[model samples]
Target: MLNRISLRQMEYFVATAKHGSIATASAQIHISSPSISAAIAHIEAELSVQLFVRHPSKGLGLTAIGTLVLQQCEDVLSQSSRLYEIAAESSAAIQGSLRVGSFQSLTAMIAPEVIFGFSRAFDRVELQMVEGDQEVLMNKLRALEIDLAITYDLHQGDDIEFECLATLPPYVLVGEVHPMAQLRTITLEELAPQPLVLLDLPMSRDYFTSLFAKAGLTPNIVARSSSTEVVRSMVANGIGYALFNIRPKSNLSLDGKRTVRVRLAGENRPMLLGLATYKAMKQSRLTRVFMERCRAYISDQYIPGMSSSAFFDRYVSGS
Candidate 1:
């Protein structure tokens, strides 16, 4: 009888899929390239399905079946790491590695409160955090690199589950000396004529632009940047007014320039801040406890962040 598929094969397959090529996977996992290739070939022969499309010049691409298989392999590896934790749970102590990911734009203000606080509470858990854009975070979630992700609920599907912790309403950001800076509330119609500094990230950009469309006005966008701080600094430097949902703890820009946060008026729907996890994936005990910490921190922190400044308009009339 043919030898059964091995755990080592699954590990090699997962590494290969994550790194995109045998050579790169070998380098990452400290395995020989030929060994990795042989392991993948044996699995393909056993399963009778092509896991990856060979692109000599370009890198490996997953076949449709391979995409599904990758999820299984990742889950297996993730669970293997958690096995120690599960075994240790008999001692009534929650101690293990907790890997996490989050949106890059949200790291500064969020990391200290959530990630740091969690670490303090769970003195035994080893926490790992990786910051990336929305696409990168989603990819990591699918690949099981993170136990769970703290991110905006911009996209949701059957493949993932998002639990909303807070709602951030969109608002206008302006320079400290701008004419509208002192206003308690300003409508999109009035702000549309001014030069705009767009944050210009994928889903976020679409959401901000859609606000103008709903108001039946066209924005005169003059400057755009993918970096959140770049857009904020531009606004602080009088480049243009920008729209944002998250309110920083301070009004100062990266370079110490002051910016004003004005509450937006009209029918603006809030963006949800939430935790995203893969559907059907097993949650570790540490993950469950960390999730509770996340919920509690956001419960207290979200409202305060919104209420601390002019960024969110919870009380302004006609908002």
Candidate 2:
């Protein structure tokens, strides 16, 4: 009978265990305290094992059996989530809400595709996007403010998990008239003399600055903007050159200026773009498939910022 306990009971059990009290669990997940107690009572009675050792002075402490039961409850919940995910994927319609966070740079590049693209393909899905720098985005993920994030693998922590989809190799961004744009491949040193249009966001700023630092030089940054589009527009108008990893399908700026993406002729470590989620939380059906959508986007090169023909021409033919 205990083995047949329902998922709701297990949810109450896990929530109670995490919060250390039935009342706390009630507040945590917005269930009544008595309901949580009743679920725990049912599980204990059916199993004929003491799940928690109670004390008047203390709230609740997991007995040896309780500890083991908690682990199993968590496992069950995780598997149950997967079961739902599988079912949702098989049906003609997938219905749920997805809250997404992304690094500011990737948002303009990837958001419309994931939000509107999936909405068109699937039966129904409510989509939301939050854009920020690396720290802001990760903080939201840890606090459970967002379901998942799409960003570079700039930082890794124990509380988070990153599923890498594709790699964005570093390249220099220049205008059509920039001297370096004429070359097949430009070296960082040659561009050092020109003013730099730095993309001044948190981790992103560091990344661009390091590119010059790695080559034993410093950038003469004349313009700085937190916005990726502004940086690109600035460079396209020939204010200064910039560095970037990914190239959009259209090289022309909004103002009808052509932006040049020149491959760097140096040994540089490339940045990886992927999905980030909390390690402990079980992924909902919406998030899992949305992640799949992102992975598919990479494979199909269906993103506006990335050119499909260019990716295939460069990676597929050579490999």
Candidate 3:
């Protein structure tokens, strides 16, 4: 009788016991209440024990035998989970569910090439993508909600392992008709007096502001936006100049307004784009393969949807 019990039945039984109600367990596990009740009854009948005592007002209380059985069930479930880990570790094939998280701004540009490309290359792997700011992605990594993150090296603690793929330095964006648009390169001092459109994101905001702080200059921020595209659009409309690391393939904003990318005159701190994963989590084959794909696709030489870094030298040097 015990041999006839499936892992799904055991899972249903454990969920019911933990929640103390079939309906509650069903809701949590996305199973029907009748299915949970049937699993519990089957387990109780097979073991010849009254697993739970029900009350009309109260939900259910575990019997002494149920308490003991619950412990055994939990242990069995734990062991059963290890089997999958063992198989994955031993298998050479790259096939499994890979949950990837990316910075919100990068997803639109980088996903088509790096993410979808990987899926097309490896047909067996099931890829799930999530996008958020640095803080959100870090939280997701720690909570096991995401397997890895595509982001910059920002506020990363010892618990995170980051691999650098590219170095992106800050540049200015302005409408084609802006006063500074004719200039190939501009300095922070020159930008200080201009009305700025700020990218107001968590760690990103701090990083951008810190550059001004280090140069002992204050930006005259006339506008702020959390979305990168919004900031670009504001700049294109001649509202204010903006700073950004990403150089979109097109100089045109989302609304088809023309914008210019002016290189910063002096060397500043460049953001390191990289892969971030939970330090303690062992890399699965799928994760390893995905990381490999990212490395092959993105680098100092080239990035998916951004202009090449080589052009930065020609612009800043006035060559």
Candidate 4:
């Protein structure tokens, strides 16, 4: 029988080629640099061809032969992924495991309840949760490291389908002592001059900037933090006010001072929170059931007035 390249060696080679550096690839795959070099050397020896041209300063560069081999390697990897997908579909049982990803703040607030309910209902299905910022979660979803993700409105590509679960209206959180706390509603003009504490995440930063731009006002951002709790704390401490879409269950306070939430007058920056999955993947029976349960839960618990008829008409049409 003719000698064949192992999947492990192919994986290492593909990683090195994609990264363009052995050290970087090793770090990514959690292997040592010497091990990677040795694997590449062994693969080259097996094929009797040099795969990469290593320069003293410019790092690894692929030769023409290397490029051809890399293209074949990619095809092999794709076929391997498809094979796994086929196996997963064949085993189509909801009783196995599911890996879910979501933003940190959202996971902190909503995921616990949902997970708890899901576990009670589907006792055989094991749940694994990964929490991060929007970008991290989305990247993980694209990489196939997660089965599903719940996140804010990305408003971009149509590759990943979105099933919007809820929409939260925008509101300003200010310390009880702040001047705006007394008002029932505040205008964008009234909020423009104040120093703001922003979430500092990409989605939030862009949303707030667009909101201010529409009002012909530029906000004076004095503080920027990725932590939602920290931003709420800053607002509670009277450092600055924050604009957020979610309606917090409990008032966030700093040093015993409660922050008041006031609806923004004539302002509508309702965040569309939803479940997202790749359109290419085969929808498992469990996934479909989970989605249906999610829709039912949202309709019965969150938005009572919003009917399933309306939800399907808007977000789930042709989904």
Candidate 5:
């Protein structure tokens, strides 16, 4: 029975237990639902104990025996992961699985060059990326769900360590036809009266609103969305100007409408783009190499898929 149970079966079980559904686990791990279900069934057959109690609407729940078995499975997976780590340490080649998380807004820009490039450079390593807001990424780091996260230096507690890479100052996005789009720079006072399309992600929302709060003004928020692309599209359609930090290379929205980025004036807080990790967790060779790759790839002068530093310099200099 023990010989029949494989590590892949344990991985499927762990993913299902963590997510509470076979379908959700299949999506996350890129496996088919039937495969996961079969693995779960095989594990149960070998052990002769039911692992999950299925519900029609509520999804699956771990039985008493299942809960006990889940803990052992996690331990086995952890031990198996360490084998790769041990092999990597003995050899000069970097080879292991790395789970990286990125802020939702930064994922599309950085993933191509920074994250995916690392995997290509180190062919032996298996890299997976998860995207979320600041709050979600922080929680994942704490839970050991992701090895590292590329995010802003916001709300980072004592338990997390942040290494700053670049400073992305706030900017405004406006439709090409908007009056303010012609301006060299914009201030919070000038912006307070206009309709605002807010990128309303967790800590991000607070950061943008705080800029108004500190100036003793409230923005006239007309629309809101958690997605950056959605906010860009709304701005391009003349919904309202939105505030942002990571400037993409393209001025056109996904809908093919042109949008303009105007520099935000005055001394406002800038988001520090950087890597985040759990302070208590020991650095594995794979993680350390990946961090090095990130540092080399991202900087103030250049960020992959974002507007060039020349654009930033010209805007700030009012050229």
Candidate 6:
């Protein structure tokens, strides 16, 4: 019976052959030199072939048979790499299920497009979206109940990693006829005296409170609500101006007229739309591919003044 050869032996053999030294090959492959030497020795013993001519001063030299074996080893290794890549591509392309958690505001805005893009690219992927506030979403992420999360930069601990995708400056929304609507921007101090309708959510409230503290001012709260739409409706009806991160697509006008969106005068703190994933969680092949697609899609669509075509070409080409 022919002697059986393991993939590891072939890999070590090929690396040693290509580099001309076991030390260099070990460094390249992140393995110890002793291990590489032992693997080659074991393979030689099994095959009963003197593959390498090791000299006292000169490094390893391949014998005639070793040279032929090395050529075949290269072919085998190349095929193995291709097989892995094909399997990964198939896994990425397969339709499966992904459970995602996202904030309420994102569900109506970015989440839909992200889901659509993922579905279009990987038609076999069935998307399940769970909508909640930041706290709820973060809790689910910590518990591993969701595969991925889209939310604000909560500055969660080291266990969770946040990647900011887009940044939108803080703005104030008010009725078109409101006095402040005529101005392009109003200072935090200037708006300090007006009645404010707070979002009442923990994240939003904390962010605004910190902003107010930084500005050395305080807002007089007349009403509070968790619903962004409700806040917009109240602002449109002249209840009060509400500070928000992004300009709303709808409710720009309450009753057929455009409402007002004014950029705050002071340093505009950006609200970041980002992705969050657990640092410790082992990412599956499908998950990694989907994440890559998400990043590519976001960069293509959201990045301004950059040529998406050129960027994609450079990225895919690995240049």
lDDT of each: 0.78, 0.76, 0.83, 0.71, 0.86, 0.70
lDDT of 1 by residue, 1-319 (tens): 6545555668889999988988899899875665567668767887899999978787999999999988988887688557544645643546789888878888877787678766775577789999987777888889999989988877656799898876777888889899988788898889888999999887788889889898788999998999999999999999999999887766889999998877787779888888999987888877877776576456312322234222133333324
The candidate that wins on TM-score is: 5
Residue clash pairs of candidate 1? none
Given candidate 1, what's the lDDT at residue 286? 79
Evaluate model 5: give its lDDT.
0.86
Q: Which regions of candidate 5 are displaced past 4 Å?
A: 1-93, 315-318
lDDT of 3: 0.83
Which is the leading candidate under lDDT? 5
lDDT of 6 by residue, 148-253 (tens): 7877886567788888765666777778789988777778888888989888886778887677888777888899999877778788888899888754445454
Candidate 3: 10-residue stretch with minimal lDDT: 1-10
Instruction: Give the TM-score of each candidate.
Output: 0.66, 0.66, 0.70, 0.63, 0.71, 0.64
**What's the C-alpha lDDT at position 306 in model 1?**
31
- Please give the lDDT score at residue 224 for candidate 3: 98
- lDDT for each residue of candidate 5 in 1-319, tens digit (9 for 90 to 100): 1524666678889999999998899899876665567668768988999999988888999999999999999998898677546655655548778999999999999998889987876678888999999999999999999998999999989999999887898989899999998998888999999999999999999999999999999999999999999999999999999999997878899999999888888999999999999999988977987786676567654566775445565754568
Q: What's the count of clashing pairs in each model shown?
A: 0, 1, 0, 0, 0, 5
Tens-place lDDT per residue, model 2, 32-106, is 564567668768977888888777888788999999999998997898677546656775437777788878877
Error of 4 at 225 (Å): 1.1
Ranking according to TM-score, highest score first: 5, 3, 1, 2, 6, 4
Better of 3 and 4 by TM-score: 3
Candidate 1 vs candidate 5, lDDT winner: 5
TM-score of candidate 1 relative to the true fold:
0.66
Name the TM-score of candidate 5. Answer: 0.71
Stretches of model 6 off by over 4 angstroms after superposition: 1-89, 251-257, 299-319
Local error of candidate 1 at 79, Å?
Answer: 30
C-alpha RMSD of each candidate structure in angstroms: 20.9, 19.8, 21.9, 20.9, 19.3, 18.3
